[model samples]
Target: MPAIVVERLSKTYFTYKRPPGVWSAVKSLFRRERHEIQAVRDISFTIEEGELVGFLGPNGAGKTTTLKMLSGIIFPTSGAARVLGYVPWERHAEMQRQIALVMGQKMQLWWDLPPYESYLLLKALYEVPDDAFEKRVHELAEMLEIRHVLHTQVRRLSLGERMKCELLAALLHRPRVLFLDEPTIGLDVVSQKRIREFLREYNQRERTTILLTSHYMQDVQELAQRVLIIHHGQLIFDDTLRALVERYSPSKALHLRLEQPADAETLSRFGRIVRMDGLEAVLEVPRELVSRVASEILQSLPVYDITIEEVDIDEIIRDIFAGKREAGALVNTAGS
Candidate 1:
């Protein structure tokens, strides 16, 4: 059975609107105007057990709204969602016990107390057995390399240190499902890599179902093979990360080191010159014509070395989010 299932799930927020003028603000007290913001619109997908899926979108594109609905933090305005076979918005204890939501901007840790105290509180709340809790804490602390700071006040810890503690507290119960939002936000490269390694091992060993949302493309590329992209409050693409590049990216990048200096005008005949420095040049060539263009360049120009590269995943995703390209008519290859 799928670990989570959502059909036509959506959330709309209503907020009061007021004009800029003082008179308009005064008049809006008695006759107020409300605007409907569609945070999520007709979004639907299914995540099978043990699958790690990345949820992606620009700001205000509804990624966090959908996550909130799935985590039972807020109710969806319409549609149905079943997480581990339970309606999330119902706030059932059994369902709550099986899922964990971690948001980078939000904290469950007590600012003034040591993280150990917070862990104890969570242990009692989750009804975790004493022996099991001790084992889990040891394992998680060792993996996160935060054992040294467990007794330190949360407010005094560094951003990376505090994030590690937050993750430990969330996973103390060993929940079956994890909803992660920007878990690596503000973390340095080393900390981000460490966290990714921990998440990879945890998912593989425990088979935890993960739904992750992040602005960092590296996190998605390193951890998730499948990605779901949302735009304008709707799902615009759902497919393997490799397939996303193949379907949307139209050109390949060519880097060439010339035996002799060549001007921009001379390289323009082959393809669009993206950058050039001295004898080195970078060109954007159509995918289908890459080999042909490279051959012609070597035969015609003084070429020393050349390498063809696929478009960067970051660039492709940026284009998709900017509406510069659309996910064409290819069949969805996400579940496979």
Candidate 2:
């Protein structure tokens, strides 16, 4: 069975918009006004066991709201969701025992105490055996290279160290399904790479199913093969990373190194010049015309070397989100 099955799961919130003035607030005391905001709109998808799926969207795209619903933190307004054969919204103990949720901005560990104490607290809460708890903590600390800082207070640790400790706390019970929302939000490049490597290794060794949401495209590119893209609270694309690039990206980049200097005017005839320097130029050409343009440039210009490559994944996805490119449903099933 799929680790997660969500069918038309949606959450709508009712909030009121009031004026800033105190007089307006007093006037509205007798008559209250409210507005409806559709946070998630009938979005549906499924994730199979052991699959690492990236959930992507812009701000206020309902990514966090959806995660909250799936993690049983908040009840959905309508539709159904099941994680590990149990309804997540029902908040069953057995189901809770097998799933974990980690939010980058939120803290589950005690601020004044060291991570060791928090781990012990979680171990007790989960009813983990004493011996098993020790073994698991040691193993995770070593894997995350955080053994040195495990005894340090949570408030004293660096951002990366705190994030690692958060992961350790969430995984102490060895949950089968993991929900990670912006796990590497503000970390540096090196820190982000470390977390990704640890998560990848853990997923492989334990066959854990993970659903990750992040604004950083590198996180998705490095970890997930399948992706679910949400836009304006709607599911827009669901497919492999390769398929997404192929279906939505319309152009390829052609980089050329000329034996002699080339002027911008001369390069413009070949294709759209994205960048130009003394003897090097980068051109953007339609996918179908890339080969033809490359051949013409080689024959017509004093070219030393030329390489054709697809557009960067981050740029392609950005254009899609900005509505510069239209990407229709690339898969028949919403989730596979």
Candidate 3:
């Protein structure tokens, strides 16, 4: 069975739709206004054992909300979600034992106490075997490179150090599944890469299914084999990173340089003139029309250097959402 299954799972929050003005606030105070905001809408997907999936979207796009549901932190407003053959919202001990959640923005460690103290408390709460507990702590601390800061008060540690400790704390039980929400939010390049590498290696070593959400494209690009993109509380895409690139990317760019200044009017006919400088110009054109446009530009001007390349996934998705790139179909490239 799949480790996680979410079928038509949705979350709608009732929030007051307050009008702008002091008078409106006074009126709302007495009337108690409310509006239904659908945080997640009819989203359905299943994750297999040990699959690493990236949950991606802009801010307030229900990424965290979905993680909360899977981790049993919050209940869905409608539909159903099951993790490890148990309803997550029910919060049963059996389900809880198998999963872990790490939120980079929130601290689970106590500020007044050292991270070691926090780990001890968790070890007690989870009733981890004494030998296993020590083994796990030492291993994770060494891997996260926080062995030296283990005894330092959580409040005194730098943000990067604290984040690493928090991650270790979340994995104390060696969970079968991990829900990571912005696991490397504010860290520098080195820290972020370290976390990603550790998570990837840990997942492979233990067969731990992982669902990660992050704003950093590098995190998704390097770690996740599959991605689910949410926009306006809806799943806009669910496929491999390559499929997202292929489906939305209809064109490639052609960068050109000429011997001398070229006519601006002549350049417009070749393709969308993205940029131009003196005799050099770049055009965004359909991949199929690449040769045609290049030939036309060459015939029209004294072309010097020219190059064509496939568009990156980032720009392709941008055009797709901006109503520019056409997503006529969904192709699964998870293996690729």
For model 2, the run of ten residues with the poorest summed lDDT:
327-336
> lDDT by residue for model 3 over 1-336, one digit each (tens)?
889988898999888788899999899889867888899998888889999999988788899999998898888998898899999989999888889999999989999999999989999988999999999999998888999999999999998899999989999998888999999999999989999888888888889999999988889999999998887777778898876765677677899888987777888888889998887788899877999888887787788989997787776656655657554435233522
Would you list the C-alpha lDDT of every candidate in the order shown?
Answer: 0.91, 0.91, 0.86
lDDT of 2 at 229: 93
Number of backbone-clashing residue pairs for each candidate, in the order shown:
0, 0, 0
For model 1, the superposed segments whose C-alpha errors exceed 4 Å read 19-30, 258-279, 288-303, 327-336
Q: Comparing 1 and 2 by TM-score, which wins?
A: 2
Q: Please give each candidate's TM-score.
A: 0.88, 0.90, 0.82
- Name the lDDT of candidate 2: 0.91
Alpha-carbon shift of residue 305 in model 1 (angstroms): 2.7
- lDDT per residue for candidate 1 within 266-295, as digits (tens), equals 899999999999989999999889999999
Model 1 whole-model lDDT (C-alpha atoms): 0.91
- 2 or 3, greater by lDDT: 2
What ordering of candidates by TM-score runs from best to worst? 2, 1, 3
Best by TM-score: 2
* Cα RMSD (angstroms) for every candidate in the order listed: 3.0, 2.7, 4.4
Q: How does model 3 fare in lDDT? A: 0.86
Q: What's the TM for model 2?
A: 0.90
lDDT of 2 by residue, 1-336 (tens): 999999998889999778789988997897668889898999888889999999998889999999999989999999999999999989999999999999998988899999999998898889999999999999999999999999999999999999999999999999999999999999999999999999999999999999999999999999999999998888988889888887887788899999999888989998899999889899999888999999999889999999999878998888988988886765438344
